[model samples]
Target: MLLSSAKLALQDAIEASPLPDDPELQRNLSEYFPAPMRQAYKKQIDNHRLRRDIIATDLANRIVNRLGLIHPYELAEEESVGLAEVASAFVAAERLFDVREIWEELDEAAMPEATRLILFDRAASAMRIQMADVLRISNGFRMPSDVVDELGRGVQKLSTGTEKLLADESLVLTTRLQREFASAGAPEKLAAKVTHLFDLDGAVGLADLAKRTEIDPRKLTNAFTILGQDLGLAWAQGTAALMSPSDVWERLLVAGLARDFQQMRLEFLQRLTRRKGMKDNPCETVNAWLDENAGAIRQFRSMITRARAHTPVAPAMLAQIASQARNVLSR
Candidate 1:
């Protein structure tokens, strides 16, 4: 989806390109254009890419402005070359921290099993990816560059960088860890735990595994501190984009809603979700919750439909979440 902010950026990038004034230069831009962008007007491509670079930088600035120098929001570094790596790194780290806080204030019981499992799984994955990457770099490797920076004075286009995060994911974790685990190295130690936690899929107890692996309980106490707390969560959360195609679109839409709920129904549901009695049976309760957050639901609808030329529905499972959200509001 094109963000409203980026629509203007795209237009401005077109205006700035050298191609518009020179037909021959325009032809070259077309000839050299990558396949994904081949269909775009050559002039448009130059202008868009140029502007997109600026927008990417601007996005960098905006993050800096609000969050300061934090994981996902921070400047691109050698470590961040694998953009997908960082995407999961940031969100997974963030979720780990968030879960820890919630666990402290309440308990793991406060979170839905599915949610916790997903979060824990992501945290483990993020740690594994980062540790492997640090090893990759120290052994001599470099990350690719960000597509561009900032908006308007530029445009900000999104791409997977040069790497495609595949579904089968031939991530050589097994081979890499087999080599790394034989050592007394710290990352390897962590990687071993990552392998277990990830492999066990939330079945491994944080304490039990620490004993079996002959690792420190305190050291194993918090995976976030061992890796990046916020970075891991942010990494997992960001990789929501990389989920199987069947899963992503709606998840993003729901996420878009979760971030913006404002009505009484939503507020009530939010409050209830954060409360103790939140159970698997919250369907009726959720309805009540929705009745409380109707305005927020409307706000969500507005965001999706805001710049739309046509009313869109994907007929996906995500609609279930939206429907559930509305059901809560209606009650």
Candidate 2:
């Protein structure tokens, strides 16, 4: 309940664009917010310009989610979370021109470069998702499950949320390409051997990518969130043939996503279990990690495909990508 409340408060803060005064806001939320929660929220707010930064993000997500359930053949690009990648790029410009369309009204200041880029990427992504490359390969493809049946083996697992600046930037660069290529709808788009601004192997960390590409790690992080959600598959629950796509996706995918999402979420717990910091394997710590991370490993590893089109990963990233392959098997 506290987590739920805290999450709601954070989302509200993002939407309303207010800096919560620890003393005043915390006191106001006193009935709903606990002391510990106030302290934590304050510390985070103080630590990062998170409130200022989220200004564009909350808006982008808002628009992308609005354009849902397009024909699989359309391949429109939505934002990171939605199905599209190409059209997502354009949505930014469209939103800029149509300021009064969604928001109450806007000053020219509203369509900053950051906001513009985000919306455009989301709109383009909408187009890409419509294409649904995997689903499109099959003729007379009538169902999402068609993908689950064939080439399910071809799907790749998304890596856990990493906090690296270079990796973050690379993802940002790659995601934009995913949108563009997704619009291009060529086999080489998601595949390797295509030249892009950032190469998968060009840099391995946020710092490196930022230095080389001039993209700040902090900015890259937000873009990364969108990219991960976009590139990541949406396998929600399973609906009975009697069920709708929404039902099947929810029953099937959400559990797996949540299972893995939580697994990596307990990062510190996982690190301890591996005994990475100890001089030798502390059997106790090892057991603790296994006890905690085992389920995540199980659920997570099962969902990876080990390969995505054209893209090849180093051993570590490849292992990370393999989860998609496994999800198909179990499902």
Candidate 3:
């Protein structure tokens, strides 16, 4: 494909080359041409040849890199000589990174099936054909099916371990711990725990928090301390508006909602699977699925509603948390 493409490109360049200024003069001389006219033709042909060589060299280097034949940086020291060398280097490179990077590259390139098409569009067809052949040979050198399966199973086990951790009552423990700190007059730790607990609940997970929070524990401690100070100031300024026993109870109630919501979602999933034969997936059967779990859903909703009804300090409390977040972020 690449060789044919190169031939076509040369043909197009030759066809587009200007004939003599006067067509009749050129026909009179038959195939013979003046020196200046011949020079012009030779210059145009040379220009096309140079361009083809540059493009071919670039395509060759990319093929070599993709196959893991050579590092891109090393191309300066060890350049491919021609199309055949590019093809040979590609085969070698595929083996070099076969375990990981090569597979990842092919996967990103949408390989095995669509790889040929993707490569053809990117480079000359000769280069694409060579790449496709190298990829096929690389497939034969892949890890054994059993080893791949074992790796897949190991991944599944790690995922299950994560899910088990999420299912733990650790949130409840942390919430109680925060309240204890609050009661003990360690508002900085209390706020830090609150921030930490919420961060843990997020998709970012605990590992990220551990890496980030430990970097400046002192800074975080100060932010929460300032937050505690601000809350005190807010309460001093508007005690009747911001402070209430019910507000504390309401936050506790809100914190517990995370656990309840997780349970409710799991229950819905279970009911959904059991009903799948009779109904479509949630995309089409969400209302019916909800209807089946209406009682449990209603109970969870009532708890949230009750919690909100008890949360007397809304905008004021949210403002405090926002202030604390800004303080921490600024630090």
Candidate 4:
């Protein structure tokens, strides 16, 4: 028979004769009546009290699958209900269907066990998909207002219940800050100190942290600059609004000084080690080496001290090197 002829026949049969609520009967109907004819049967039963619940269950499945809801088990209880409400709203708007009646039928224990399970599973899947999409778009960051607004209008509109799933801006910023600090090789002690500064109520200031941690102000500023550059200066600056223009100059000066100090320290250590084997009196050799590099060491210390007030005149590593050299000479 032609598909249209089959549809009309199914419709007439559904209205005139009650169909058995059996899976086999449903399969036989599909095999004999054809695919297009099934929808015709659905439409015919749209008003029929006997099969309306079945039609709603099928419609619910279609709505959820269209919304990309494939995983039902992952959604929370509230999320699942919110998704169902969204599906119910869409059905009322687009299909002129009464989801309330479907819920009523299920509540009144009139809907078949099989149909109820299908509705529950589909609704759960839809909610999971909706929350997943919100997270995906936010990218663990504060979603842009325009994007949020646009999402509110898109197919899976953000209803009042689902809006809570959006990422919190401050939380996202804190997470990114921690990640950047770790990436910048900040020591765990230093990173924890900096992170604690952010956790306080006000804007994080580099100078305030320098005083609190007793770290060199220039080093603190340099660390902040590295983090800011890595995470975009605008975002980092927004988080630490007290950053000043002088911080940029301090970063450059600190970077150059650190590099020069490291190179000089390496050369001095290498020369001392080589001379230890060459000379019998280690004290003589050590004094000669110190005398040779005294001017360079003095210059480095003076430059570092001038860069930041009240900072240690020389880095602890430099002081440690001197201590080690003195111990060698004494031995």
lDDT by candidate, in order shown:
0.32, 0.32, 0.32, 0.34
List model 2 lDDT by residue over 84-174, tens digit each. Answer: 2222222322222222242222112244455434444443332232232222232322232333332222121111223242334344555
lDDT of 4 by residue, 63-123 (tens): 4433334232222122333333333223322211122333334344433456445444433
Model 1 residue 51 lDDT? 45
Highest lDDT: which candidate? 4
In model 3, residue pairs whose N, Cα or C atoms come closer than 3 Å (at least 3 residues apart or on different chains), thus clashing, are 2-125, 2-126, 67-93, 67-94, 68-93, 69-93
**lDDT by residue for model 3 over 238-313, one digit each (tens)?**
2221222345545333332322222232233334334453222332344454455556545544533443465454
Q: Model 1, 92-155: lDDT tens per residue?
A: 3223222224223222234444543443444434433332322222222211111111110111
Question: How many collisions per candidate?
Answer: 56, 78, 6, 0
TM-score for all predictions? 0.21, 0.24, 0.19, 0.19
Q: Which TM-score value belongs to model 4?
A: 0.19
All candidates: CA RMSD (Å): 21.4, 18.5, 27.8, 26.3
Give the runs in model 4 whose Cα sits over 4 Å from its true position: 1-33, 36-43, 59-70, 78-83, 86-331
Candidate 3: which stretches are off by over 4 Å?
1-260, 277-280, 293-300, 312-331
Residue 225, model 3: lDDT of: 25
Model 2 global lDDT (CA atoms, 0 to 1): 0.32
Task: Supply candidate 2's per-residue lDDT for 135.
Answer: 21
